[model samples]
Target chain A: MVPSEAKKYLSKEQFIHQAFSYLEKGVEPTVKTLWLNDEIQEKITEILEHSYPKLRLRYWQHDDQTVWFLDEIGKERPISFGISVKSQRINLVKVLEFRESRGGEIHMQAFTEQFDQIKLTDDNKLNKHIDGITGATMSVSAMKKIARVALMLDKEVR
Target chain B: MKFKLALVSAALLACGTVNAAEPTNQELLDLIKSQQKEIENLKKSVEEADEKAEASVEAAEKTMSNAADSKLSFGGYGELHYNNIEDKESIDFHRFVTFMGYEFNEDIRFFSELEVEHSLSGDGKPGEVELEQAYVEIDVTDATSIKSGLFLVPVGILNETHEPPTFYGVERNPVEKNIIPSTWWEAGAGVTTELAAGITADFAIHSGLEVPNDGGVYDFNIRSGRQKVAKANADSFAYTARIKYTAIPGLELAASIQHQTDLTQGVLNADANLYTAHAIYNVDGFGIRALYAGWDVDSEQAELAGQDKQDGFFVEPSYRFNDEFGVFARYSEWDNVAGNSIDTEMEQTNVGFNYWPHQNVVFKFDLERRDGAQDGDGFNLGVGYQF
Candidate 1:
């Protein structure tokens, strides 16, 4: 079930609007939103724990979408965020875009592929992993970490 | 004349002087028509002459452009490496590479590579100058093209991917070179293409001729004293193909196969075949790679009976501390199948750091440990650029 307080957050249109507004504010937002219930959230949290041992996620609910942001405690500039959802049988994870210097555009395709393989269960982490592209390794890796954070966010926000 | 006419008019006034003026309306009209005809002829002649002059100027410009193009372009890439080895020879090698490309037209281009290896050797006793690659390429489209000439065999990572900065080490891994051959270029022709959704592939036919010169020998045909004085056949051919997939972000997998017939162009031809599978994965600051390659050679002059096969494997792990600096390590091992050589097995470890102050250039230092049967067991450091 969706949370009662989730309605206070932005809808899809409002979310897109706010995202652009935040970008214009000079704040690089790493955002992730997904749909999930409590039990799947717990399983996803376990998956993310292995993926991102150093990160903890904070999130909020807004009608149908679960909005999550990666909170960087000590860093400035070049922050990334992502979101994952687990409902019944399907699990989805996505990195909600970030800015990279120059060749960042080349990294997008590989990042998309990495997110598609986000599995919220440790029963097959190695089997589901992929080798990075020759030049886009860093961006792809950063996105993977953000996806993990998003999966963790699902557990807490739910 | 006018006074006489007036006198006669007054006497004949007398007569019909007034009726004489109306005699010929037709004659006055004909006089005006003749002047118009002369003006029209002049205008037509002027227009035709102007057109001829314009055509001549256009022809001259085209001729000049063709003369200037002559189908030529200049490009090259080089690397300098520095390294510290564990207990033996350390390596310091610098390479200066230059190539001249000539476009025969939209369909054909000729290319050649001239490299100064270990330039520090200086003057007479210094490093050698080698002709690394020479070939002609035909572009069918932006997505597909064919190249024939001397080229790197498409067997392993180092053969086709030998851009200095593309790999981790100051030099290529030992397994890659001993098993797959480094700086390997031969006469061949092949097709390379990119399909819809970003699938890339290359297929080529290469000359299986190997020059018997040392790695540092520049002009194989010109050099006098060298081991294995056999020249590469002008007509030997080999076949190669590589297929790659990028279905996932930050990940790519590729496989390559190559076959060369005999060491020379002759019947009962000796032949060599190589196969490889390689993959790379990236997650943020970290990268991981694994590759395997195998080679098989068939020759009646058995260098080693049943020892005509060689194979190897390698793995590399790397991390970028930040954008400008990174560290990487690699491990590899190879077994030589040529039974005639004293060196049969080789293993090596390489650790290196790279600094890229700019995108197109890099400075690198590599230290390696080799417990192998080759004089190449030393370390290498290099700096290379691409533009």
Candidate 2:
């Protein structure tokens, strides 16, 4: 697989976005999403070495042999998106977590068919997710993804 | 003077210089030799000046170098609590909680809070020592920072924001402690960010240990018995989230939730969940705070802790008479309706006074009463400090 192609069109964020997009559009993401994450991580390291260079992906596997990819990145601090696919349907969950604070979490609705995966959980939920922080939704959102990605990548290899 | 002239003439002859001179000629040669020596010394001084200039330029470049290197700082705070109960069956309670922190830099730091319940570290003693909160943090910016290791969830007022002086009386609110789990810290990492004016949010995934009510405290720290919060296809992990709003100046409000899957993978191992809402308001040294929390567990072990669906709330109002003196009262209630222990309810009331002669030190006296479950209460006096 050419890692360079995925890196060209997708920022690491874009790769994660596409992962959810496929799930929303009722299409299954190939193993390529995993490869895309690695490629972007490598490219990012070349440019932004001090920042975290890894992306994690997660999926939902239930008891009925049904497997759905979770678009959510990690459960730890640095929130991420959740993606799942089952019965021609994709479910996306947005989750957030912080280091010292408690209970600031936000989750958004499932997106399907025409909507891009760029949607946020909502201002009320975002406000709730951040607790007392103000004017940093985008940063909080990105941290959610990093948290999700770390969780996802850890899952894939294990 | 003659001796010097003779030496100069000899020196010039050795250097392939023919000295055909009278007495005045010798003196002129000596002056020339002295001038040459002076020039050599001047050259050495000029070379030293050039070296010094280069060194100064190097020092300037090193200024920002140390700026990026992490700065280390150490700080800590502690709590000494006391309680007095009006009931004849009551026993007084006292405890201490101290936290020491090291900030490596604005980017990262480490903090740990140690607790001694009843001032002993034994099964049946006056106190117990515990590493209450321990964690490492990597701050990305003022608005966002990632933290890992073990720490408290930002679900309510008492869990993460509990400092002795910050609260009114000896013990934390009942709703926050039993219902929301005060001093509840786990192993995980999450982020913190500001949402808008007077609002902030936090969430995390942490290690969840399944300790039955009968399970001793030691059960929480053992290998194989504990679970690591993993991403996917992993056996152990718990997800947590919290949001807070402070738009009301001295008034802060928050809500939080936590969920975990089958912890021990045994008979009746079920998911566990908790939710809470909290508020604190301070108007003109008259402070008031309230909290509500609920916990549910679908596990066989739930019976041991009487874990059904438990909901509780508390309201506290305090008035500061002056900078060094204040009086406060707190009322708390909890109801447990799940599990095998049957339905149980608890209520507590506390009246206390506080005196602070110094900014970092405080003294407190509290009288408390408990009714229904756990039928014990007492009075206590205490002192605490932070630095």
Candidate 3:
């Protein structure tokens, strides 16, 4: 993994294009798209137990690191996760934002740290363990599913 | 002051003593020594400054992180029901519940559930206000946790997770409600350990139940023995243990056993033991559920009264057409007095449908047929929500 990779999208808001800055100060990140065809959509449905919200997903890449800003429902509200993949493994995972009334414990560093350096296996399963919180089972499950999605997407980009 | 003067005088003598622009060895030594001392002081000062900066950064990070992680979250669910049975009809606000949770840090948390049953509580009223669950859970490690306070016993599928929309039927299933006793809790301390894969085990010791003897109260009913962790007699205690496997996606299997030293609280030398097991499997919107629970009361009077051995089992097969609609049929049979031949067993069949306008809100309707001890036909309609 390259520790000193040039980061064009410095903050999470900038990475997800949620922040507005001086137009001359920053160039728009070069975005790429992955369309959810029947085959890929089926695989994603198997991973998430639900369909993707849109037909295509937009992501950003810098050197060997790629970023995915994804959303999944936790109980009744959607939770957004910012996942970074480097060299086909998880480089970082963070809760960019949360809308659920409960299950905020999933954003704790002790819990999110478990995803670092993890990758998908031959059968497309996580190679590491993700522990579930006492009252945040659904939220934890959502995070795991998003992690797998990011890894799979990384493989496609590669 | 002498050192500074000697250094200045050495410099002046060195300039006059340098006939060929070269200073004496002693002058050079004094100059280098003084310069070296000045460099050491700068290095020391920089080191201290760096330490202070790092400490300040650490404090800022800790504050921001804790503000994000230590949260107080609230959620709740409520249900209203209408049931008509054998020409008798009743419409009631069944339950109003509130849940509160506070995360003290990454390792400690507090949770509580408060409920109002039948929607009212007062003198000569048929409702009650109860604290069904309250506990503080401390993480001993990433894989293990210990909790203490009043908590629902980890015995059956619904006892620990019984939001109205999460389950089928208007009322709780009879087997869990009558035999294992749904919504049962006690003040106790327990440890939960998660092992490899998705396996978990729990063990706890808590207050026991006290069933009045025949002369004072009915002995055949096990559901009436609940003390609800109120200010009551605690001459003896109960121990419970459970283990579950959930490694396989969309599947869960679990079993629990509880032993009570005495259920009569020294009233009849009576004690009762309970055993329960359940399985749930779901795939592609199709699901099935099965459970069995039994009780063994060790008292001569309990046996003579034909209520020593009480047990039941139920199976339900359900299919979800989509996220918003589902249907199911269940068969349940239970007997509170099975110690001897008494023909008191009750068998029932229920068919139900649940409609979810939103994931957290649901509308439910079901029809039931009761045979064996009681013969009747009834149907229930309800609406429930959780947020």
Candidate 3 per-residue lDDT, tens place, B275-387, comes to 99999877666788899999999988889878789999999999887768999999999998888786988999999999998656899999999999989999999999887
lDDT of 1 by residue, B111-181 (tens): 67777888754577568777777777665764566777666566555665555656677777766666666
Output the lDDT of residue A34, model 3.
77
Question: Which candidate wins on DockQ?
Answer: 1
Candidates by TM-score, descending order: 3, 1, 2
Error at B188, model 1, angstroms: 2.7
Which digits, one per residue and each the tens of the lDDT, describe model 3 over residues A60-146?
Answer: 776666778887766544677888887899978887665443355566666778788999998788986555553355677789989
Misplaced by over 4 Å in model 1 are A1-158, B1-74, B83-92, B100-111, B120-126, B210-231, B264-268, B303-306, B338-343, B372-381
Q: List the candidates' TM-scores in order.
A: 0.53, 0.52, 0.67
Candidate 1 per-residue lDDT, tens place, A1-158, comes to 00000001224445444434424455443454343445444555554332222222334443333445441110111324434344311133333433221113223444454455354454423224444455433444445545555544544554
Sort candidate 2 into its docking category.
Answer: incorrect
Judged by whole-model lDDT over C-alpha atoms, candidate 1 comes out at: 0.56
Mark the regions of model 3 whose C-alpha exceeds 4 Å error after superposition.
Answer: A1-66, A69-137, A140-158, B1-70
TM-score of chain A of each: 0.44, 0.29, 0.81
Q: For each candidate, what is chain B's TM-score?
A: 0.67, 0.69, 0.82
Ranking by DockQ: 1, 3, 2
TM-score of chain B of 2: 0.69
